[model samples]
Target: MGTWLRRVLLGGLLITQGAVQAAEVTFDDIQPILQARCVMCHAGEAAPLGLRLTRLDELLKGSKGRPVVNAGDPAGSELVRRLKGISQPRMPMTGPPFLSDAEIALFEDWIAGGLKAGRNPPDTPVAPAPLQRPAAGQPVTYAHVAPIFASRCVKCHSAYGLMGSAPEGLLLNSYAAILDRHERVRVVPGAAGASELVRRIRGQSQPQMPYDGPPFLSDEEIQLIVDWIDQGARDTNGQPAPSPVGARVRLQGVLGEGWTLDSLPLVVGPGTRIDKAPEVGDYVEVRGRWGQDGRVLVERIRRR
Candidate 1:
C-alpha cells in the first residue's frame, strides 16, 4: 500500500457513512438500485447508450459522451427525466418500477447535493504505523502474534468460528485455549516445514480458514507468520519456545511483470461461481496443496 493510496482509502472511509446517511447518495445505497433496475439492459455487451450501471463509478460518470447528472440539477439531468416517465422508452423496460419514491428521492437529494463521493468506514481503526513483526532471532511471543491474529483472523474466527468447529470442542478464542489444544497444532517454532497450522492456511489441509469467503491471507501475511514461527513460537511470559513448521502447501498466483499471462485459475473457492473473463495479465493468487505429481486443487483465489 503506497502512502498516497492509503491516504485516499482513509479519506474515503472517513466520510463515507456520514455522507450516505445524510445525503443518501452512496455506493451502498445506489448500487442495489442500479443492479436491480439498470443492469438488466445497461450492462455487458448490450449496454444502452454505452451506459453501464454495474459499478458506482460508471453510473456516476455516465456514458461515453453524456454526463449522467448535472451534479445537483435534476431538471437539467436527462436521467431524472427518463426515470420520471417523461422520456421515450423508459428505463427498466419491463416489470414493476424498480425504485420506490423514497429511492428516487434519494437520487434527487444526492444530485441536488453535488454528487458527493462515498466512503467505507473502518470498523476498527488501524494506526498509521506499520505492524511490526518479530525479529529474525526472537521468538513468536503471544503478545506479538496476538495482535496480528486480532487484526485479521479474529474478525471471523471469534464469532462465526472459521478455524474449527465449535461443537467439536475446538476454539481459538484465546491464547491459552489455543495453546492447550489436544494436538497443539497452532505453532511449532524452529520447524517451519512441519506445522499443521501453516499447512491449513497454505491449503495443504481441507477447507481453508477464513471460510466465509475467498482470499484468505496474502503472501505477505503468510510470510509474517512464518517469520515469527521461524524465529521461535514463545508466549509473552518468555517461557520455552515452541517449534513451527512450513507445510508443503504453496500459494500460486499470477504476477504482472513485463510479460503477459494467457491463463489463470478461473474457478477457485469451495462451491463458488466463476463467470467472468479475467483481464489479460491481471494477477491472481491461488492457494492449493502440491500433489506428488505436482498438480494442485485450488482452494481459494484473490487478486495479487
Candidate 2:
C-alpha cells in the first residue's frame, strides 16, 4: 500500500475511535454542566420559554413548542446553536461566564453520542407505591394544600431551606403565612381562574410555579389546587374540594448525579429502600414526596 494511502486509512481509524468515545457521553457527564450553567433559568415553571434542563426527558420533550436537543445531530440541535451563538439570544441568558469551549464541546459530544442517559449507583432504590388521593368529598383547605406545598414549594419558598434564594418573597410553608402575604395576592377565595397560584401552575402566567419542570404538576394535582381556591381558599371544613396526596413519579431513564432520574433530583434518606443495584438506562419507579427544590425524597424505588 502507498504511504499516503496508509496515512489516510490511519486517520480514518482515529476519527472513528473518537466518534465511538464521544457516543459514551451520558447524562452523568453533562449534568454538572447543566446544573451549574443551565438550571438557573431552565428550571421550574418560570423557566423562560418553558425550557427545562433538569432532566434528559425534559430536554427531549423541549419547550412548549419544540425539542432543544436533537440526538445524534449536534449541528442541528437548538441547544448547540444557542451555545455556539448561531441562534439568536445566546443561552445561559446570564452569561459573561458563558460555557467554556471545553464545556460546550462536552455537550456537542453528548449529542453526537446519541444522548445516552447516565447510570445510577448500585444501591439506588426502586420507586414506591402510588400516592393515594384524599377520599372523595374532603374539604379543600390548608390541611390538604399544605402537603402539596411541603413536597413541592417549600425548598425554595420556605423561610429557611436549601436550594437557593426564594423568588419574589413568596412563601408557601404554612396557611397563615401564605394568606397573610399581601405583596401579591396568590389566592383569591372563590376564584380559581383569578388566583395567581392557579395561573402560575397552569402556565397562564409568565414562568410557571414549581419553577423547575417540564414535568409540571399533573392535571389532577392542578385541579385539586384550583378546586381548593375556587371553594374559598379556607383552612379546612369550609367546603369540599379535591385533595390529592403526594405524587408518585415512575419513570425510565438513566440516573444522573446524586439520585436523579433523567435529571430530576431524588432525595433519599433513612426511609428510602433499595431492592437491587440499578445501572444507567435501567427503568426504575420512584415513590416519594416531591420537594420544593424539585427533587423527590424517594421512600421507595422499584427496578423493573
User: Which candidate should be chosen as best, given TM-score against the real structure?
Assistant: 2
Clash count, one per candidate = 15, 20
Give per-model CA RMSD: 21.3, 22.2
lDDT against the true structure, per candidate, is 0.52, 0.65
Per-residue CA lDDT of model 2 for 156-243, tens digit only, reads 6754434545577776755655654345355655656444577677775546778766678889778878777777777645553222
Over the stretch 130-198, how does candidate 1's per-residue lDDT look in tens digits?
445657666555555554454444434433333334423534445655444353344445534334456
Distance from true location, Cα of 297 in model 1, Å:
26
Candidate 1 off by > 4 Å: 1-129, 135-137, 159-168, 242-304
TM-score of each: 0.34, 0.36
